[model samples]
Structure formats: structure tokens, C-alpha cells
Target: MRCRGLSTLAAVLLLAGGVPARAAGPLLVNGNGDPLVWGVNPIPFNPDRGTLGTLDNAAAVQAVLDDFGVWAAVPTANISFTNAGALPVDVTVANYLSYLGVCGDGLSPIIFDTDGSITDDAFGPGASNDILGFASPECGSFVPPQIAEGVAVLNGKWIDGVDSPSNPEIPLADFKGVFVHEFGHYVNLDHSQINLVEGFDDDPSNDDAVATMFPFLATGTSTPHLDDQVAVSTLYPAASFASGFGTITGTIFRADGVTPFQGAYVIARQVGDPRLTAVGYASGARYFPSNTGGPPAPALRGLYEIPGLPAGSYTVEIEPVSHFFTDGSSVGPLDPPAALPGLPEFYNGANEAGTNPPDDPTQSVSLVVTAGATLGGINVVINGFPPAADDCSAATVISTVPFTAGFDASAATSVASDPLQSCTFGGPNQNGHSAWFTFTAPADMTLRADTTGSGYDTVLTADTGSCGALTEIACNDDSSGLQSSLTFALGAGQTVVLEVASYNAGASDVLLFHLAPVLP
Candidate 1:
């Protein structure tokens, strides 16, 4: 578990008591095994930095104790935490650098940044003052590594509530919520994405998620949500955890019925309470297929597992990551919808995905699960095409010239951090979340592909032939002020593939995929 930086500013007051989040998506725990033991140093590592809403020594330390109690109360988890007493401050060390040494030393020290010194080291100097706290873990490998120790870092700018109520910058409740979140990382849980409208709206129109593991939570929440419990139990399951829970294993398919749909999101919601949902992804596959071993298979790529579920009647819901992409740092809505396209559906045996409207629960399939039994073959199919092309194989069938479409890079993964097709206009590897579009020559023609007025830095690439065997035609890094553009010639009946990506990885930009004919 590495240190997770705050997604948005620290001022976010995301809490709504006792309401479990709908998406308890896991980041594939970084530890080798489960049941990590954490001991928080009850002392303040750094003196107050004197910011607007900093928590004092007594209040800060107490918050950690109270927050740890939240997780300690989970019945199914074998995890237990201890207040390890005050940590000895390093006299030789002047700033937050001293606390950095504690992460790998097998000591989980809950530290407070008296000033912005620690944050400056974590992000950079003069960064935003919004981040309240962070958790650092020892990640040996890229995916699911052994977590050695976790060090929690809190911003000392504002002495938050319960410490000093008069200084009303950040309430004590908010700080406590932040502590529980970072602590989730401390114990080996990772971030998850749930769709909810942020800012001034207490009620979300889409899906309102309020889990400790969610990137951002609603304000006034204190306890661990149901999804969080499922994750913790899976990580550190007790004796009854096994007998009390069941597992769901399944695969996802494309409209063609062959291509393995990899990145789609699948959830099993309790028939009794839809909000009590457990989520996983059909992710065993990568976007790019390899020819070395053999061709791709559905079982090899499209697989999902939702374990530690309570034995009950449940309904399965499937949705694409196109609208809500999980980036490295945060998870939330993708850049405004760009015909990203994937019909969300309940597993009712048919393909046209649909959700059981929030009011109606019996509208979908009610899957029965017995404790310790794995229900398999609950397959799903996604048929609708994205407004833009999905890949060279299923490129959007386009006929109109100067066509406009949308692109989202939140779900993008870096196959190659560098440019794969061209170098001249190649920008950053933002191409990780690349989108595809293809067109056949109306009659020998030249066309220009442009992503202008895009919110983020954009890049474009052109190719010919199948995705596995692509012939790069042209590539551009930046041409229209942080946007991307390129021109290529297309012969009659020749299908040219166009790719749109961000200049930086994980950046979702709202823009048009404009393909206009090049006039002499």
C-alpha cells in the first residue's frame, strides 16, 4: 500500500451517516496476505503549522483513536489496531522528512504536518492547501504487493473541530471521516469510484455512494459502510466470515459474442437493500492482445469475482467504465459523456442493459446465493456501439465527414508510456485512455483529425488495418494549443483508424473528435 494522495481538496465534507455506498470497488489490495496489524503513534510528530483549520495535539490524537474504533467494531474482520503511544520525535530532523522514514521501518506512525512541510514533500512546494490527510504504504511490486507499514499524514494548516471549535475552517467530524479513509489504505484497502454529484447536493440523482473506501465521501458520516465491511472481511476474515458469506464469479462478452469485454463494471446488490452492493470488474484482460502465446479467450480476459457477500437474494447489474473511469489517484465521473457508449443492464439473460429504477427493486433478476457457495456463469453482454470507434476491429461505422464525437481517458491504461504509433506530434502517454474512430474513403480523399477546445492536452494517432496488426499512418502530439490534430490520406474503400488520447495519462478531457475532409 503506497501513500494515496487526496483526490480533491481537503475541504470536502463527504459524510452521510450509516448509509453504505453502492460501489465498494477494490483496487486489488497491495499486500501479499490479509489481516494487517496497525499501531498508531498517539503523539504528534510535528507541531502545528498554524493553518486555518489545523487539529491540535490532544484533538488530533483523539481523532485517530476514535476513528480507529470505527474499523475495530467490524465484526467479521480479524483486524485489530493499537494506540502505540507517542512517537519519539527526531531532534536532528527539522521538517516532515523525519516522518518519511517511518513508512518502511515496520512502524505505522500517524503523523501531523505542523505546517505544509510534509505536503510540500509529498506533492510539491506551493501546492493546494485543500488536502487534509494521506496514507503511505510499502508497495514492493506494482500490483498486490506486501504492505509493510502505513504512515498517516495530516495537514496541520487548520486546527479542526473537537480540538478548537472556535476555528471553524474544518469540523472535527470531517477530520475524523478523512482519518477513517486514509486508515483504510493503512490496513491494505485501496480506493474505489462511485458516481455521485459533488457540491451542494445532499441527494444524488444517479448513484449516491458513501463508503470509507470511496475516493470522496458525503459529509457527517462516521461509521464504515457495508461495502467497506465486505472489503475488510475479505482482507482479514474471521471464522464466521467464511460461513456467513458467498461468492459470485462470472464473465462478460461483446455484442459479437466473442470479444472479451474487459473493463466493464459488475455489481451484485442485495435484493433486500440495493445500496448494500459489492462490486468487481471484468478485468482479467488487457486492452491490447498479445500474439506471442495465442489468441485471446473470454475466460482468459473477461472474469470478475465478488466475494464475502452475505447469503441472500441479489440482482446483478453491469455497467461500462466509460462513464465512470477510475484513474490512479481518484474515481468519479468521466469527462462529460462523449457517446462513450455501453448500455448498463441487469443480468436478465438479455443484452440491452437496464437498471431497476431506484424505486422498483423486483424489475430485475433476483439471484439467490447460499453461504460459501459460488454462483457461476452469470454472464452479461454489451452490444451498443460507442459514438466513436471502440477499436480498429469494431470501429464505429461512420459515413459523415467533419463528424464530432466525445472521448474519455479515465479508463485508459498505459500499454506503452511513450508514443506507440508516431513521434513527431506525440504528446505525453495520455494515450493510455485512447479512443478509436475509423472511416472508409468516400472516394480517394485527404482528411484532418482534430481534437480542439478540449479541456485537457490531447493527442491523435492514425493507423491502418487490424488492432493487433496496425500500420501507423500519422501521429500528432499537440497542434491546437494543448489539443491534437493530424492529416492523412485515405484511398477509396480504405478504412483508416483514428485514435484520440490525453497528453497526460488519466486526464479526462471533454472535447470533440472532429474529422473533416482536407480541401485543396
Candidate 2:
């Protein structure tokens, strides 16, 4: 039977004021007493299982799960339909919770029905409790199921009518992809780990092809990307809960040849079977771009310190700020260096390094940070232009120039270039560029920028993207006009680009970009 009144809980909570402030401690998991769960059978027109609909059945679900190496027996239930028109939010929410293992009298499962009210279709307790549900009509809007606090809600309409002519069934693989994503939320996976992708490595330009949990929704081909598996296994390891693993500490700095980068994210992931990769706080942490917490290292001037790591070998990544341009104009206050020909109307020009494109790492080094030992000398350097001639005017000209051809990160003479262009930029001139780099994404990232030339109007900007259109994420154009920095999200395979240019034309020798990855 379709449940009523349950769908309104989410609205009531919103009306009563959203999530209450949470005090610091280990993040709470599945603490909610009233858990909601949802269920669906693929018989849209037929009320009996004999005429079961065309959508993927339990066998299909099991096959997809097997692809990810997760084995579970599908449960059978005699789900009765009351010709209730549509499922209710209460039922959807309850079902959603049950799928994630989040119901009971302290653990009893709470079931609700979707009465098909478009407005009241979806239900949830917001980011705090991590439980929610929605009707089939609403489910069409989101590809994957979502969760909060161990809840599993489904769109019964979509599930039943998955094979409808107007709305054909989504691929079984895609269905599994959605389930995996929603289950991620049940365990508190934040929208991709922002800091880890943005600020930790040298090149913040390349996209992470292996990140399963990247923010993009599934299209029915369910397969966990490397990052996705890393995230899930890390937060909810196979082993039972235990405490007191040793910690590892280290700093990530710019390469020896370039200026120190700040506010970049640094991440460390175990190298081995995807299922065994370390995650959460154990995967890696972040340090801010400004290094406000402390001083740079003696050898590496812009050093970042990361702490609390389980002992293991890890891949490291660094990225710039995570922002994108939308309207083809300026992103924040930073102006374009020069409008390129035939540019799009709305573009993102925040991350336009002469050499290093967003997601492109200037350096990559393998090191082991012991469970309790502090490691040092992990320096990443960007190539800088050599000194100009002695003439004062020449010096001014050289200093004011935004970038030197010699310093481009793509100019690396040592390594073979990947056929894929690393970074890109957006702004008035479509000249905005992107770079690609590979690194381990820790839990957080920081970004920082500096201006070396005498120009008074230089500014810094940044953006982020997974596989689709880039979005404006963050930017900083300090009124002082010399330096700026910020920290933001980083998804695996996600690219972050930074743009350094004059606020106004006529200013030259104006910009410098520095990235540093801090671990905690």
C-alpha cells in the first residue's frame, strides 16, 4: 500500500529550519532512529509478477553487483500494488533507507508508498540524517539513487515503467551505476572529494579517467572507477572497525625549477588492488594554499605537511583551484590577458598558466611515509624563465610579461607527452587553456598565487570539471593586487585550471602561480 504523511517529513524539517549545527567529532554514521526504506517491482501495467515488466530484474541486479566484485543474494518479496496511481514519498524514502541497510527500531525498516504526487514525490532528511525518497516522476531527474544516514529510496514509477515506450528502460549497467552512487551517499560520501583533486599535485590539468565516484551521473554502464572503489573501500573497509593505526607525515612542494604553488591539493592513495586502497582520513588530507598554519620547508620553500596516514605506498596528485566560468565574461574580478580570436561568449579564464594547465602535474615522485615517521624532501618545481638582461627597461619588460614560452609545463623535454591536451581556459578569448597531470587525490586541497612583476592589476582565477561542461567553482582577486589563495573540492579525473592575468591591460610582468599540497 502507498504510504502518506511520510513524504512530508522532509518538508517539515526544511520548514522547521534545516540541519542543526554539528559539533566536531568523528562524523556520525547511521545515528537516526527512524529509517525509511522503499521497494519496487517492474510491473507497471500488470499487477501480477507473471507479466513482470521489462526493466532489469533481480538477476540483472546480481550480475551488475558481480561486476564490481560485490556478491549479494537478491531478496524476493510479494510486493502488492493497490492501483494507487503512483508511489508516495514515504514509501520511496523508506525503501531507499532499507536498500542501504539503515532501518530498525534502532534498526527496524520503515516502509512508505509513493502516491505519485509530483510535488511530494521525493522525501529526505537533508544532509544531516542522510535519508530521502522521491516518486518515479521525480526520479527521472536523477540517474542514481541518493542516500543520507543509511537510507535507500527508489522511484517506483521509474522502476515499474522502466520499459515504457515513452521512457524506455535504463540499461541494467546504468541501474547498477545509480545504486552504487546512492549507496556511496548512505555511507556519507561527499560530492567528490574536492580538496584531494584540486590542490595536492603539480599539474592540475588532466582528467581522472579511473575515478568511479566522479560527480557525473551514471548512464547505465555500471563500473567502479579506481577512485570510486578507493573512496568506498576506504570509508567502509571490509574489515570490522578498529582504531589506532599509525600515522605518516610529509610535505608536497613545487618542483625545484618553478615558483612555490599554494592552495593546491595533495592526495595519497595506496597502490594495489582497487578494493584495498586506503581512504577517508586515511587516504590523505589537505593544507591551505597560504600555508597560514606554518612556515615553508627549509629545502622546499612552499612545503605542505600531511599527517595521519596508514602505512603504504601511495600515488600523489596536486591540483589548482576548482572553479569554472559560465557567462563568457570575467570569472570573479580577474580580467583576461588578451582576448583570443573566435572565442565563445561565456568562458572560464581563471586557470591559464603559460606552462602548467590545470590537472597537469609538474612533478611526480614516489615515497613512503611510515606509520609514525616524518618524511621530507618531496619538492615539485615548475620551470621558471631565466633572468632577463641587465637593462632596467629590459628587466621591466621581462618582469611584466605574464608568461615566458620557455616555462610552459608542456615543454618538458624529459617525458613523452600524452596525446591528450592537459588543460584549457575560458573567457572572452576562448584562449583559455587546460593541462593534464596525474597524482593521488588526498582528502582535501589548498591553492595559492603570487605576482612577481611590477603590474598593479594582476589577479588569479580557477575552475573545475569532470567530463562535462566546466563550472565556475572559485576565484580570488585581492584588492591589494599582489597575492591570493583559496581551498576547494577535487574529484578524481576532475581538472582545476588557474588563470593569472592583469585586471586591466597595459600591465605586464604581472603574474606567478604557486601550488602546494598539505596533508593532515
Task: Put down candidate 1 lDDT per residue, 54-80, tens digits, no spaces.
Answer: 555676676777777677678987766
> Model 2 off-target regions past 4 Å?
1-149, 155-169, 191-209, 218-226, 238-315, 321-361, 368-520
Candidate lDDT scores, in order, read 0.53, 0.29
Q: Model 1 compared with the native: what TM-score?
A: 0.58
Candidate 1 Cα RMSD after full superposition onto the native fold (Å): 14.1
lDDT of 1: 0.53
Poorest 10 consecutive residues by lDDT, candidate 1: 13-22
Q: What is the C-alpha lDDT profile of model 2 across 385-415, one tens digit per residue? A: 4222212112122111111121222221111
